[model samples]
Target chain A: MSKTIYIAGLGLIGGSLALAIRKAHPTYRILGYNRPEKSQQIARERGMVNDLTDDFASFAPLADIIILAVPIKQTILFLKELAQLDLKKGVIITDVGSTKQEIVAVAEVCFANREIDFIGGHPMAGSHKSGAIAADVSLFENAYYIFTPTQFTQERALTSLKDLFKGTGARYIEVAADEHDRVTSQISHFPHILATSLMLQTGDYAESHEHTKYFTAGGFRDMTRIAESEPDLWTSILLSNSRAVLDRIEEFKERLDEVAQLIFQKNEPAIWKFFNQGRAMRQAMEIHKKGGVDSFYDLFVEVPDEEDVVLKILELLRGISLVNLHINEENREDSHGVLQLTFKNAQDLATAEVIIKNNTDYHITIT
Target chain B: MSKTIYIAGLGLIGGSLALAIRKAHPTYRILGYNRPEKSQQIARERGMVNDLTDDFASFAPLADIIILAVPIKQTILFLKELAQLDLKKGVIITDVGSTKQEIVAVAEVCFANREIDFIGGHPMAGSHKSGAIAADVSLFENAYYIFTPTQFTQERALTSLKDLFKGTGARYIEVAADEHDRVTSQISHFPHILATSLMLQTGDYAESHEHTKYFTAGGFRDMTRIAESEPDLWTSILLSNSRAVLDRIEEFKERLDEVAQLIFQKNEPAIWKFFNQGRAMRQAMEIHKKGGVDSFYDLFVEVPDEEDVVLKILELLRGISLVNLHINEENREDSHGVLQLTFKNAQDLATAEVIIKNNTDYHITIT
Candidate 1:
């Protein structure tokens, strides 16, 4: 019989991974160890795994691989508990937590000479939305999966963990656990902290300016919208990765100060050069392998009120033979509407215009 | 015959306005004065206006409105030209620039006659792309259009200009040009400068780090994507709006310093509170009107390659239909590709899932 894979904490990351592994390796028996009854049911119903239960011990010894996908605090607690468990000598253990240095330190300090082997993993797949409700089997598809293999990390366990993610359509990158935390702190965590801080300052002044209500247009919303992320999760990440976060924060300060000084000196040429360099650099950076950066353009749409106008337009464009068309009604507002049409070439836009104008009386324009 | 409207520069903002004004006010004859011969041809071919010409003199005397949408430096130059021309008395003159204080100052210093009324106008509408090719009339449909009226401004001229923008489906706001510059420097101009500078720094670092290829995700992309905007234009804005931009840069520095101080002190509680405050304020803030703030979820789409697959899914979804659909053959990458489907609610999601799984062999998932 194939080994059973046990996923502790059946939330977005865990549940989604369960589903992804099941599809990729159908012969493997997947078990979910969920604390909440609702989470277990959600996991089972979503076809995340073959079985679900709360008894960790009964399955702990039987599991070939165990994935810990929980908060940083909870991860430490779970590691503490798992360290004392009677496990098979070669059992592989891994986690999907944002911060790794602290967790790796805890593992080394507490689980010395443990039968089970641990490897730190962080798949750079995230969304502002959380919980099992947001879980989808394909979340990790095409995303970069980082493996932080510490000096204490067992080689075989790391290989097994990488193989598991490889089956899920994820690309792998390896780094030191401490280095992982530091990199994310500079690139990810620090940006979140800076965004939140900017938001706080904007809020302090927002109360006094009513015109700011109208002024916070597309650019402002895009720049500051990340500020609305869950505070608890960010707080946890910041505390765990304080050193890295502070380092990036200081770096950002220096960059900002240079701009201030240039502006203060009234060096128009220097300021212009500064602005030009940034624009060129931003334009030149190659896109990452995963989903491109989140922009305000992704979040803003105007929805127009109408029930049948959409269907009428679709019928009008039936002759064009489009591969796909997407519309979202939940986020649609009362006065504006967004229609995203995919075309094989620029010629299709012309066909779309005629169809939209001919079938629907509402004004339809190409984006 | 209705009054003629003369637009300078014939770029995105100026050309789009000409197109929208012609559509909304059919009686109005629109004429474009583009510097480049190519721009005039493109604008005429795009039907952005009824007439496109290089002769500013031909239309200058007969115009009821003159919109100067050129670069700020050119704007001052154009003002000098308009100041010398035999222009109609009480003919309303307005501009569509990001910064207002500097332009307002120029108007006060140069055009002191008060005979040629200059109501400093700024329509807060922009796109990541640029030039006449990317111009669209609907870009400013729901955008905020502000008029910075100084002490010498006439009441009737201000009212007339407001009516003109109302015709273009824009809401008008009033503010002192200096105040407008200050507020925008904080919200709009400063963000642009910061985004560009950060991107430049990252780009500089990318040259050394092998992992630079993987860092462009989430907030980094969104924060820096705007940095990919037009360089010469941004450089001009920074030089023109130096004081206000510097003030904002200082404000951000102070905020960064406060966060850094707490980090050094290990004050987790204070840092957490600061993040929470930002989250709360961003959540409570309105989506439109003030600072380009908007809701975050409306921006992106997850699409697949097959047409029948998407249509089958849409067919299953009750009451939810597509507004437009096109198949882009040139843009296709994978064989069993994703299709973009937009739906109204949970029922639509459920119905679509059933159809997708039942009809197509490809796996279907909602983002």
Candidate 2:
């Protein structure tokens, strides 16, 4: 029998999940629910779902599995509404939210006397770009999919949910709801706030010193890139995970204040140790090998400024199975340029390095 | 008549300047001075300079131009020692340091009763990689070289120094020493500290939650990339510009604390306004063109995941006059990949985009 999977919120995650399941299981029927009716119509036109609905009451009883891919607040409201509905027995329900503790707590209350199984999930994979237009079947490939289940959750339902997501090529790890919220607050949410703060600080400085704006080079740009993130989405996240974010901020401020005091005292040894600690910690991050996520080895090659010379070098590399080649054009002048080549794996980079050494006289350095 | 130039400090900046000047003016004699004598010896073997000297007192009076390229503290000390030399009549003296006010002030006091001319200079070009091995002849080509001259500076001396650096193809800008320090502290020094603090915060978070380390993605990496910078170098910079750095930190903290309050109170309107402000300010930054400094236009193209398919697309682009091509390897899985092409100028990017549109069916987006 073909399973009926209902996905609420036809945005990037929901749309991509629907498409991935459709591609993998031709017989499974995917139904998408979203607001305004236009999004549902679009999702149908895009072939992301076999059916579309704006009303949840009619579809709640038909779904064997339900995935809520909305913001944290909306997901809570939807869980409350679903609790009032007569969902099928043994139905599996889950959510793709940035925070888990709040949502999982609500799920526990809503399903306390109900038959529906609720599990909180988060896929640690997404782009800055959002919406259905940016959706892809490969978004979750090799990504870590974290699941948080309550004591009331059934093992059969958890196993089935894992099997369903297996076709998306995600690695699964089960964690406690509170633990998921705390860890993500540290790694993802807190860093985002820092990026935004850095931008505002630089922007304030740029207002007085206009030339400083022009001097905002690669490092500054990279450090604050997340400042360009979606406002509505981030606001929802910040509000839902307020306690954890604020706690992390207080901890960060203490660390920064220590450095600030050291600078004021002109304490050279203390400052040296602080900087070395940061460097050592950053260098200790384990490089992910199999993920389609962000793990790359970069190689920089010095090339002459001539267009023909750079083209010739690319031509030579095109014959080899390398990953990506780009010119560091901003770092180039009229006489010299730097060519950056990226590889998904280290072996591919080694192979390209050998080929370049055997073929060209260009100086290459792996960064 | 050919001129002689003496450069103290054979690190990345000084060594590259020597090689660039040598390439442009073949007949000009260049002498390099560095400690331990081994660095100067290596520079000579690499053809960076004509002569190597460890004793600065014997060689300081022989050159028409003297360049002091060292850290901020060392640059000030060198100025005092150079002021004691009595042979030179009108030799133009300059030092390349990140902070300008202190160095320029020291130079004024040292050269008050002497015949030597002292001027402050800062070249706004550098790489994360340092040392003699990373030095190249074209490092300063099209880079911004700022000069701060005291009230006692001679017009003829300024003109002669400009003429000497013209061969290296650096664009010149004259500004007040205090103004340069203030602007650089805003854009460069403050951002470095923020990067370090973000890393420390994340490191603290990762200690208890080990799984959090694996979830650090592109945004986190980009924001903390400079955290891997040299400890001693950054220590010197933070201390030398401690006042400005601390001021900026206080200002930044005010803004961050405001946002944290809004998040705590669930002030949706205020949070929306703050995020929009950051986005607008980031969008308003002027894109730099025609510099050896970092600036590039990025174009993204969707391609199939096969190695041969990617190679074929690269081959097609190789036939075009594109400057740099890199693949977004972290974004690629078994079925989908995006290739990024970078161009030095806007015109070249448009040309390549048109060529790709005309020749292939690949979906392209200029980011």
Identify the candidate with maximal DockQ.
2
CA RMSD, predictions in order: 9.2, 5.3
Instruction: Give the per-residue lDDT of model 2 (tens digit) for B1-367.
Output: 7988999988888988887787777889998788865566669778988887887667888888999988887888888888888747888899888888888888899888777888899887788656665576656665788899878989988888887777666778888888887777877788788888888877877788877777777777777888888888888888777888898888777877888899889898888777777777777763222222454566788877765665565556664555456655445424567777766456667877887799889899975
The interface RMSD values of the models, given in order, are 7.1, 4.6
Q: What local lDDT does model 1 show for residue A193?
A: 69
Error of 2 at A266 (Å): 0.6
Q: Give the docking tier of candidate 2.
A: acceptable
Mark the regions of model 2 whose C-alpha exceeds 4 Å error after superposition.
A36-42, A287-323, A326-367, B36-42, B286-293, B296-323, B327-340, B343-367
Q: After superposition, how far is residue A318 of candidate 1 from its true place, in Å?
A: 12
Error of 2 at B22 (Å): 2.5
Q: Which ten residues in a row have the lowest lDDT in candidate 2 chain B?
A: B286-295
Q: What tens-digit string does per-residue lDDT give for candidate 1 at A39-133?
A: 77767777887877787656776689988888888888878888877877778888899898998888777667766778888877766546665
Task: Note the clash tally of each candidate.
Answer: 40, 9
lDDT of 2 at B38: 52
TM-score of chain A of 2: 0.82
TM-score of chain B of each: 0.78, 0.83
Docking quality band of candidate 1, CAPRI definitions: acceptable
